[model samples]
Target: MSDPNRPGHPEDQPPQGQPGLGPTPPPPPGQYGQYGQYGQYGQYGQPAQPPYGQPPYGGPGPLSQDEITWGSAAHWSALVAAFVALAFLGPLIVMLTKGTQSAYVRRQAVESLNFQLSILIYGIVSLALCLVLIGFLLLPIVGVVWLVFTILAAVRAGQGEEYHYPLTIRMVS
Candidate 1:
């Protein structure tokens, strides 16, 4: 089946920058594509050629599901694990599940889990220390600091950024 998001058949795509001679124009509106409504070019608009070495293919066609899965899971695992015990297990499972299965996903999930666990431990320590203070009002402030750390890490990871957790216990690679 022709991909609705894309156009024409895969075999018909001409090499980038080399539209085969006698190229056919995209179908006008009201014409039914095997997929759906045509966009800028039509059912099989021009091959989405991107500048060389710029993350390759454009418009979301280039990313494999595995890449997206890894990054997304890793970023969220950190934040989610903080609230849910099951989420705490996310990283451990990912580490054991074989990063080889999908290196990108495995890496992301493990890193996120590690970072979150660290933050959780730090919060506990901070709270205990706060109890020793006169007002003990400093406990919430410490929690907020760690929360900020988790938020920033998650946002960066979501954007495909790689960050290592400081002082994480390296139980798995």
Candidate 2:
């Protein structure tokens, strides 16, 4: 019932005389089809390892979801600490802990720490300037900048992006 003139029809193809030029050979032994019995997983149900047999070197790998959350927390925690008049404490704590687990989190915490330290320094300088009447304006400006930057950093970290504060003195690597 097949049409003889149709292209790629079984009846229109050349005869399979040589095995090398013919259809693919059946899989050997216990393999089931192209993927075999284990499918994408390697033998014995274990995941397939990288071909190089070693994890990729240089730089921290992709940030996981947990890392991203912790990274954001590293920034937000600064705000919480600020209420207690210890702006550096939050990020410092986060850095000492979660920072060890993720480079991204470490970076966020370090940046926050540096920024908080800078703000503290600025506040001290502005308070000193208050004796000369210039600190009256500078002190409020510093407070506003601190609030704005802390929120900005937290939002950026939550979005899985990095943030750098302006006029910050980086004390930690």
- lDDT string for model 2 (53-157, tens) is 544442546768898899889888988988899999999999999988777888899999999999999999999999999999999999999999999999999
Against the true structure, candidate 1 reaches a TM-score of: 0.48
In model 1, residue pairs whose N, Cα or C atoms come closer than 3 Å (at least 3 residues apart or on different chains), thus clashing, are: 7-43, 70-105
State the lDDT at 134 in candidate 1. 35
lDDT of 1 at 61: 39
**Model 1 stretches astray by more than 4 angstroms:** 1-63, 85-87, 96-100, 134-138, 166-171
The lDDT of each candidate is: 0.59, 0.83
Where is the poorest 10-residue window by lDDT in model 2? 42-51
Which residues of candidate 2, in runs, are more than 4 Å off? 1-61
Query: Which candidate leads in lDDT?
Result: 2
